[model samples]
Target: MAASSKRTICIVSPGTARDNNGNWHTADRWARFLRDDYDVVVQERWSARWPAPDLLVALHARRSARSLGEFREYHDDRPAILVLTGTDVYHDIHRDSDAECAVLLADALVVLQPAAIGELPDIVRPNTHVIYQSADALPTLPGVPGRKDVTMVGHLREVKDPATFMRAAALVTAPGVFLQQIGAALDADLERLAERTNDTVEHYAWQGGAPREYARDAIRRSHALAVCSTMEGGANVIVEAITSGVPVLASDISGNRGMLGDDYAGFFPVGDAAALARLIDRSVQDDAFIATLRAQCAARAPLFAPEAERAALLRLVDNLFHSIPSIGKRT
Candidate 1:
């Protein structure tokens, strides 16, 4: 590539990468969006052997802490964008020094959902931008009327609270209702809970981990998606559900509220199985309530569309290159 050509941008996300999975999917998605205008490379980490790029976009403050630090040391004057994840905003930024340092070192910051802006310190707030995660709208499946199936999509971790959905299923006394939880178990306790819940008579099933296509297909087929996370920076699952036109029954957290609006009617208190159960029962029994949620979700769906995200990303890159003196010299 010549100096006058499009700038080469490197995205450094130290956490695991997947061809098609949770957070990795978000990283890959952004790379695909940027490919048309910039030379983009996605990597697990940055090291001494790697060639320096015109700009750096690192994901997850905590997991990419070392990479962020190293890039700052080598390319302090380069345009570097730090993207925050749920764990980084909700937990690490407050407690981890390395994570906090990553925020200060970046030229600009990106948060997937809107509410995350409030979590930043006063100084960092000015450079922060909210980029709502986007998804490709899947082909809509034929509406299977009268089937009372609710779906939850997330890996079984301490933050995800898979048990909340299981316990909620036990409390639901609705006749035809069924609860399906999908995700890999990362925690031993959650794995045991899944086993115990399966042995019981409640209308719950742990389908374990499925391929991304199968999981999204399941979301498209379901009546609603259950989001029971204790904390989230911005969940891509929320985007998937909204883009699929599936209504959501989410936990009442800022992250969830950020994706769904603050005025959204379908939130239950986090970790409260009874509250979740009541919402599930209401969604099945009350036609007006379900329709209301679907309407709200439909109204918000465009925010996560692929075109919107691509526009924001391109605009950010354009603006950064124009404003930053050293980066502007590259092209």
Candidate 2:
């Protein structure tokens, strides 16, 4: 394909793609979105031997640090977009040298949540863009409808705080309520927690890893989504819940707040099982309050719709290609 006729873009996500959990899936979603307009290749890793593309979009600064460095060394003049994941934005950028290098090496930075940009150093602030993740609601399930089911969707990991949701479910005094967690247990400790929670709480069930369709169906069928995360780079669960018309009870972190809005009332302090329990109780017992949260989530749902995300991404790509003198030229 001729250089001008075919726009080649490469996405580097060095994390294990087999897991297909969070950031890996995010990279896949963005790749699918870009595929229509550009020739896009998604790879777990990129090396010096890889062909140079017109643009590179990489996810997870620390995980793809080597790939980012290689891309920079090999394609210095090409525009590279580095997407900051929860770990990359919250943990690695502060402590990991490779993560910091990825930030400096990129022509532009992408953060899923608005608050994530605050975590970036002032040097890269100008180039950073906040692009919220998107999801589509699946067809409604055929099961019983009236019983309120609170769902939590995330791979069981330390950062995700799966225990918080389980503990909250156990502590919830409300009857006729269920707390379902659907994700693969990525950590041994979390697996133990899930097992224990299942044995102890009659209402809590850990339905180990389901396909994305099943997960989305769970979200659609649920009364609400509980996001008890220690940190996030704008979780896709929040977007998924919003788009599915399910209210959210999220941790009071900037990442959650960035997606749920700073003024959104459905927030509990991070890692506070008691607070989460209280929120769960209130969501079930207080109809007015729950409706208010639902309304707030509904108001913000359009921001995460597929159309909005696609437009913002295309605009970003167009601006990058047009502004960069070398890449815009048809060879």
RMSD values for the candidates in order, in angstroms, are 2.0, 1.9
**TM-score computed on alpha carbons, candidate 2:** 0.95
- In candidate 1, which residue ranges exceed 4 Å CA deviation? 1-3, 19-21, 142-146, 325-331
**Candidate 2 lDDT by residue in tens digits, 1-331:** 5566557888887654687677777778888898888888888888889678888888899988888898889878888899999899999999999998989999899999889988999999999998888987543454345677899998898899998998888788887789999999989988998999999889899999998878888888887899999998888888888887889999999899899898999999988999998888898899999999999998998889988888888889878888785773565
TM-score, predicted candidate 1 vs. hidden true structure: 0.95
The alpha-carbon lDDT assigned to residue 109 of candidate 2 equals 93
Query: In model 2, what lDDT does residue 108 have?
Result: 90
Most lDDT-accurate candidate: 2
Could you tell me which residue pairs clash in candidate 1?
86-233
Q: After superposition, how far is residue 128 of candidate 2 from its true place, in Å?
A: 0.6
Q: TM-score of each candidate?
A: 0.95, 0.95
Backbone-clash count (model 2): 0
